[model samples]
Target: MNALLFIVCVIIWGSTWIGITFQVGHVEPVVAVAWRFSIAVVCIGLWMLATRRSFRMPAHMHVKALSVGLILYTLDYSFLYAAQQYIVSALLAVLSSSVIYFTVLFRRVFLNKPLRREVLVGATLGLLGIVLIFSPEFTQMTAQQGLVLGLLFALVSFVSAAIGNILSENMLDEGVPVMQMNFYAMGYGLFFMYGYGFMSGASFTYPDHLEFTLALLYLALFGSVLAFGAYMKLLQRIGSDKSTYVVLVYPIVALGLSTLFEGYQWTLAAVFGVILVLIGNAIAMGKLNRQLKIS
Candidate 1:
């Protein structure tokens, strides 16, 4: 069940990068994100109603949802959509994979979990792989203003997402139902996006392009709702530390799509990096340790 969830999440999220790229030109990124969550919230709300899931949440859980919405939906995705304007989707995807490290680090700091050696090693290798995959883009960094800022924004987005994941894990620990939590969180996220848009003077124009509309629907339905549902479930099954191994595979699928549709070329460095990332995920998951019977 966990494996199936992981694969579904990886595949869905991988495709989201392309959807996100398509989302770029038609509307303000913030508003687009806001709309995405708005649609997602409606879907989740309907699903909850159909299944008779109560919308009642404790005050603290409501607070948790607010914070998670601000960071994860509003800030993280706001940065991500902005970053895509400055970089290729594949590069952004590669950089965003750093979330694995942040998730583990926050898990230790906030939850008082001990840092495992395998996780550390795996994070290092996986990060190195991401860098190698985008090493070619880095070489031209000096020439491209967007590249540098895009990288920075991607990092910020990663940190925001990691924080959100930790908070969600905490909420789950408190026995909040996943769909209910997400519905509320996404509602708050939409609110924050609108607030940010109002404050920043970003136009809340609705996109008319069929491509943009379809992409937005896809992002809302699959990326936000379905992918998150699978991922949160995985987090429940495996814990946040291991659940984040999804990041290890996101780049492979994102880069593959980028190469096909976005004209990304694979270099030897990127090939080597992918190999290292796979090895790192294996180690981080303790598959290698179990095989060796290491303590």
Candidate 2:
């Protein structure tokens, strides 16, 4: 179940970048985000009803869910979108790798998990791999005044995501079912997204193209609903500190997809990056250590 959920999350989220590309040009980013979660909330609510699952929770759980919504869904994405406005895509991708380390940091601080040496080593290799994968883009990045601000926003996004991961894990430890928590968290997320859209006077620019609408549905169903569901469950099965390594695999999948669809030419550096990422994953999963002992 753990491996299955992890694979589901990595593949779903990896494919989401394609869906995200289709989401643009017709809607404001935040509004699109709002729409995604709104659709997810409706679908999840229906699923809960159809499955006869209880939706009731304590008042404090509602608060916790709302907090997760604000930090994870709202602030995390808000910062990422804003950062992209000022920075290059390659830089943004590289900076986002900080999520793994931030997850480690939060787990130690909040959950009091001992900082394992392998986790840091694996995270470092994963980050280096991502940097290698985007070496060309990184080389071309210009040092503008907004670069610092963009980097800051990206870090904020990473931290927000880390907080969200830890919060979900903590909730699961408290006996909240993954689907139930996700249902409420997504509900609150939709609520905040709508609130932000209204307060910011974001215009509702609905997609007229069939492809765009299809992509939006895919995101809401696969990305928001299924992917998040699998991811949070993975978090519960394996502590957030380790499960957060999914970020490391995200870019490798993106690059492979790009090769097929975007005509991305794989350089030697990129191949090496793929190797490093795989090595990092092995380290993270403790496969290398186990194999050594078995031999």
Candidate 3:
């Protein structure tokens, strides 16, 4: 079940980059984010109501859940969308993978948990692999001020994502069910997105294009709801240190899909990158040592 959840998140979230591509031209990204979470929140809320799951929570828990949603769904996504305007998604994918290390560092700071050496080493290799995989894209880039802004946005987005991951673990530890927490958090995230949109004077430009609408729905349902649900469940089973290695993996999937649909040519470096990421995952999961002993 844990492995299944991890794979679900990896594939679904990886594919979501395509959906986000559609979201770019239709509306201001802030408005698009608002729409995405609003759809997720409503759909999830209706499901809970129909299934007779209680929405009632202690006031303090609601606050906690909302804050998690705000950071994870709102701030992380807001900055993430903004970053893409300045940099290619390949670069963003590589940058966002830093969430693994961020989560590791934050866990030690917030939970006072000893750092896991295996996870860090694995993450390091995975990060290196990603850079290699995207080396062609990186070399094609010319330096500009917008690149700096993109990097800054990506950093903030990833940090917010790492914080959200830890907070979700803490929330799960508090005994809130995963779906319910997701429901509330998405709800709060939608609120924040909407509030930010208005405050920033972002006009809510709704595109009537079928592709845009389809992409938005996909992002709301599969990307936000299904992927996130699976991910949070995986986080419960594996520690964040290990679970977030999915970040390294999902981008590979993204590139693979791009190869099919967008004619992305894979280089030899990309092949090595994939191998390293797989080996890193094995090391992190302790599979490498076991296999070595068996051999």
In order, candidate lDDTs are: 0.85, 0.84, 0.86
Give the poorly placed runs of model 2, Cα more than 4 Å off. 143-146, 290-295
Candidate 3 residue-wise lDDT, 153-177, digit = tens: 8898999999998888888877888
Candidate 2: give its CA RMSD in angstroms. Answer: 2.2
Per-model TM against the reference:
0.91, 0.93, 0.95
Relative to the true structure, candidate 2 reaches a TM of 0.93
Judge candidate 1 against the unseen true structure and give its global Cα lDDT, from 0 to 1.
Answer: 0.85
Model 2, span 193-233: residue lDDT tens: 88888898989867679988888899999998999999988
From the highest TM-score down, the ranking of the candidates is 3, 2, 1
| Candidate 1: pairs in clash | none
Cα lDDT tens digits, model 1, 177-196, are 88988998989888789988
Best by TM-score: 3
Question: Which lDDT value does model 1 have at 66?
Answer: 97
> How far does residue 115 in candidate 3 sit from its true spot (Å)?
1.0
Error of 3 at 268 (Å): 1.6
Candidate 2: minimum summed lDDT over ten consecutive residues — where?
Answer: 286-295
Give the higher-lDDT candidate: 1 or 3: 3
Find the 10 residues in a row with the least total lDDT in model 1.
Answer: 88-97
